[model samples]
Target chain A: MTMARRLRTKDLSAGYDSRVILKDISLEVPAGRITAIVGGNASGKSTLLRTLARILKPKGGSVLLDDNVIHDMPSNAVARIMGLLPQSPIAPEGITVADLVGRGRHPHHGLFSRWNAADDRAVTDALTATGIAGLAERDLDTLSGGQRQRAWIAMALAQQTDLLLLDEPTTFLDVAHQIDVLDLLVDMNLSRRTTVVMVLHDLNLAVRYADHLIAVAQGGIHCQGTPADVLTEATVKTVFGLDCRIVTDPVSGTSTMVPIGRHKSGSVGQEAQSRK
Target chain B: MTLIIDTQAAAPASHARNRGTRRAVIVLNMLGLCLVGLIALTLSCGQGCLPPAHVLAALTGADAGGADFVVNDLRLPRALMSLVVGLCFGLGGAAFQVMLRNPLASPDIIGISAGAGAAAVFAIVVLSLEGWAVSAVAVSAGLGIATLIWGLSSGRGAAGARLILVGIGVSAMLNSVTSYLLLDAPAWDRAEAMRWLTGSMNGAQLVQVWPVVAALAVFGGLLAVSARDLDLLRLGDDAARALGVRSDATRFRVTLAAVGLVAFATSAAGPVAFVAFLSGPIAARLTRGGRFILPAAGLIGAILVLAGDYAGQFMLPARLPVGVVTGAIGAPFLLLLIVKANRNGGTL
Candidate 1:
C-alpha cells in the first residue's frame, strides 16, 4: 500500500481543567493498516485517541492530516474522511437501526439536502458490511450488546472514511461477541484496506489482530512494534502487573495467553489441557 | 412477552414513510387553520356574539353597515396580539427545546423569558423607556439577557450542559431583580409593571402588532436559515464535532438567532408565561420527532395564547388577565411533563 501522512501528532499535550493527562506525546497513525493501541488501564489511551480525532484540543503541538492542521478544519470536512466510535456510544431514545445508521451520513450532507440515493447506498453498504443488514429496520435500543456494537460500527462505516478509530470496541461484550466484532474488523481490513486505530484492553486480542502495535504507558508510548515482539511475558508483567504464560494459538498461530491469577492457576490449566 | 426483533419491519423507515414531509405539511396547515379558527372564536365569542361573516367583514374593513364595532377594534387587537404572542413564544420555546435536546431547556422554564422580562422590566421601570422605545429597549434587554446566557455557556465546542445550568441560574437572579424593582415602584407604576409582568392583551393595540410581527419576521427567518445546524446540535458537542460539525461556530450562530427570537417575543408580549415551553413540545409531539419545530410551534403558540386570551377576556365575564388564564392552563401541563419525565426514567 502507498503510505502517506494520514494523521500525525507532534509534541501534543492535552488534559482536562487544571491537570495535564498527556504531555509531549508524538505519534503517527499509519495509513492502510490496523494499528492496535495496547496499554494498561488509565494510561491516557482514550485521551490520545480523542485528541487524534479532534474531540479534544491539544494544549500544545499539532495534529496533522495530509499536512492540514486538524483543529483548523470544519468538523464535517474532517468527519467525511475519518470516523471515530468511542466506547459506550449513547443512542437517542427510540432511534431505529436505520435512523442511527442514517445519521452517519450527516457529515456528507449540507443544510436543506434531502436524503438521496447516495445516502441510502452508504447506509446500506455500512449495515451489510457490519453484517447487520438483516436487522436494518430494528430499533437500536432493543439490540443485543454484540448486535448494537455492529450497529454503531455500521454508523461509523457509513462515514466511508479512510481511517476508523475505535476506543475499546469490545468492552462489555461476552467472549463470543468480542470475537464476532473482531472478525468484522478483520473483514473490513481485508476488504477495504481502511486504516484502523483502536485501544484494546485485551492484550491477547491486540496481539492476534494488530498489524502494528502502539503500546502507551505513563503519559507516552512505552514501545511500538509488531505485537509478537512487544507482547512477551515480561512486557505483559511490566505493563499490567499480571503473570501470564504466552504460547502460540494452535489454530491461528497467533499469541495466546495462559493467565496465572492466585485463585485457580494449576487445576484450570490442566482442565483446559484435557479438554483441548 | 416476546420482544419482536424484526430486521425487516419496514426497511429504511423513511422510504416506507414517503409521505413523511407531505403528512407533516398537511398536519401543519391544518393546525394553522385551527389557529385561525381559534382566533375568530376568540374575537367574537365573548360578551357580545358577532356572526363569523361579520367578524371577517370587520377585519378587512368590508363591513358596510359597521354592525360589529366591538369585533373590529377591541376583540381584533386582542386576537392579533394572541396570534403574534403565540407564534413568538412557540418558535422561541421549540427552538430552545430542540437545540438543547432537553425538554426542560425551554426558554421559559430555563429562564430565557425571565431574562428578557427582567431586562424589559428594567427598561420600563428603571430606564423609563416609553411607547415604542419602551418595547424596543425591552427587546434589546431580552436579546442582551439571551446573549449573556449563551456567552456564559460558551466552551471549546458546543455550549455544555453546565453552561445551560448557569443560564438557568442567571435567569433566576434576573427574575428576583425584576421582582424587587416591581415592589419598590410607586403604586401607579407598580400597577402598570404588574400588568406587563403577569402578561395581558387587555391594553394591546393594532400598532403593537407591527413590532411583534416585524420582530418575528426578521428573527424567524434567521432561525429558519440556521434550522439544520440546530438539528445536528441535539446529538451532543463531542458527537457533533467528531462527525465533522463545527460545534462551536454552530452553537454561537444558533444562540445568536435564539436570542434575537426570544428578545423580540418578550418585548412584544411581556414574557407571556409558558407559550415558549409548551409550544415546542406540542409541535414535536404532533410531528412525531421532526427536528426544529419553529413553524408548527409558532402556530400552536399563536392558537394557545389567542384562545387563552379569549378565555381570559370574556369566558366568564370575570375579566381575568390573559397571563392568569395561561398560568392556570400551563401549570398543569408542566406538572404532567415532570411526571412523564420521571416515569420515562430520566431526562429527554
Candidate 2:
C-alpha cells in the first residue's frame, strides 16, 4: 500500500467568483483514518471539501499536500496520490461500469501511453473490492441507485490513491443503502489504510463511521475531534441550529442526536429530559 | 485477507472494452468503404459519363484523353474538397457538441458558421476582396464570434443552454447581415456572394483544397491529442478536474481546434449547411457512442457531403448546392430533436 499522504489546509478561504463561502480556516486531515465534515445547508461543507480536493481555487491561503502547495503542484502528480468523487457526477450516456471505472487510470498514463497490466489489475481490484465485478459489463444507466453509487466509488478506488475525498457520497440513497455505502467506505479505509474524507448529511452515520468529525457552521470550523468529543447537545444546537437531545446509540455505542421538534410526543420528550 | 491480483479477474472488463473497440473498428471500415465507392462514383458519373475503368485510368495518369481533363481537372478537386471540408465540419461540430454536453450546440447551429459566412460575404461584395483575404476575414470572425458567445454565456446556472441560445441569436443577426449585403450588391456580385451564404461546391478548385487540408492537419492533430481530456469533460467540470484534467486548459485547446476547423472549412465550402451539425449524432448512433466518436463523426461528415452533393447535382430536379440538400435533411431532423427534447423535458 502507498503511504498515506498528508492533506491539510492553512487559513484556507475559498468560494465561487466574488463570493467567499468558507472563511479563513485551518485544519488537518488525519492520515489513514476516516474524517467526516458535517454541516447544515449552505454551511460551507462542500466548499471546504472542494478546496481540499483542489477543484475550487482558494480565495486566499493554501492547501498543502505532503508539505507542498497542492494548487501549485502539477495536477496529474497530485491526482496520482489523491482521488475524489464529486457529488452528482455525470456518467456519459451508455457507458459501461467497467469503462467508467477504467477511466480512473487517466492520471497514471501519459498522453500516448497504452493501458498496461497494472492498470487492469487496479481496475480488477477496485471492482472486486467494491463487490461490482459481476456488474462490470452493465451499463451505468441500468444499475440501481445503490449500485451506481458503488460503481462511482469503484472508479475512485481504481485511481489507487492514498487519500480519497468524497462529497456527500450517500445523499439520495435510502437509510439501508446509506449504511451500506458507509460500510463499504469503512471497509476500504480499514483494508487499504487510505485516508478517507467526506462531507455527509447524516450526523448519526458520520458519528458512527468516521474516526474523526469536523462540524462546520457559519463558514468556519465550529469544532473538530473524535466523534465522542464532537457530538454534543450544545454542538448540535450551535452547528445545525436545532434543539436536539444527544442520546447513546444502542447498536453502535456512539452519540446520536435526536432532534426535538414542536410536534413530538410530550411524554417522550419528558422521558428524554428526565433521563438527561 | 490475501489480495487477489490475478490477471484472469480482469477478463470480463477487458473483454467488454475489446468488444466496444471491435464495434468501432468494423463501423469505421464500412464507412471507409462507402467513402471510396462514393469518390469513384463521383469521378465517373459527371457530364460525359466516363466508365469506372476510364476514370481509374485517368486518375492513374494513363492517357484516357478527354476523361483526363474531366476527372483530373473538374471532378477531382470537387471530390477532394468535399472530403476535406466534410471532415473539418464533422470533427469541429462533434467537438463542440461533446464539449458543451448538448447535441444542439453545433457550430452551424450556434453562430460560428454564420460569423464566417457573413464576414466572407462582406469581403466579397463590399470590399471586393478575393481569395485569401476573404478566407482570412472569415476565419478571424469565426474565432471572434465563438469567443464572444463563450464570454456572454458564462456565469450562473446552465451555461450550455445559455451559450446555445445566445449563439442562435447571434447566428440570426449575422445571417441577416449577409442577406442585406447580398440584396444591395451588383447582380454579378450577388451570385458570387450567394455561394458564401448557401455553401456551394460549384467552382471548387485544386488550389482551394490545400488551405482547408492544411487547417485540418494542424487543428485535427490538436483535437486528437486533446481527445481523452475532452471525453473526461463530459463528466462535468468538477469531476473532470478531480480526475486531473485541467478543465479550463482542455476546453481552450478543444475550442481553438474546433473553431479553427469550422472557420477554415467554411472559408472553403461555405459551411456546407448541416454536415457539421448532423455528423456527430449520426456517428454516435452508428458507433453506439463508442471511443472513436471523433474519427467516426468525421467519416460520417465526409459521407454526408459527398452523398448530398451527388444527389443535388444529379438526383434532384434543379442543380442545387450541397448545402441545400443537407439543409433540407437537417431542418426536419432539428425539429424532430426539439420535439423529442420537449416530450422528454430534457435539457437539449
Question: In terms of lDDT, which candidate is strongest?
Answer: 2
Residue B120 lDDT (model 2): 82
Give a tens-digit lDDT track for model 1, residues A1-276. Answer: 223337888899877776678888887877788899888888888888888989888888988888899989877788988888877666655556776777788888887788887887788778878878777656677899999999989988888888889999999999999999988987887788888999999988988988888887777887788888887877777777667799989887988777876657797656645654
**Model 2 per-residue lDDT tens digits across residues B7-65:** 45767668767778888999999999999999988999975578788888899999886
Q: Which ten residues in a row have the lowest lDDT in candidate 1 chain A?
A: A1-10
**What is the C-alpha lDDT profile of model 2 across A53-135, one tens digit per residue?**
99989999999999999999999998899999999898887778988998899999899999888887888889889899989
DockQ of each: 0.39, 0.65
TM-score of each: 0.87, 0.96
**Least accurate stretch of 10 residues (summed lDDT) in model 2 chain B?**
B1-10
The lDDT, on a scale of 0 to 1, for candidate 1 is: 0.75
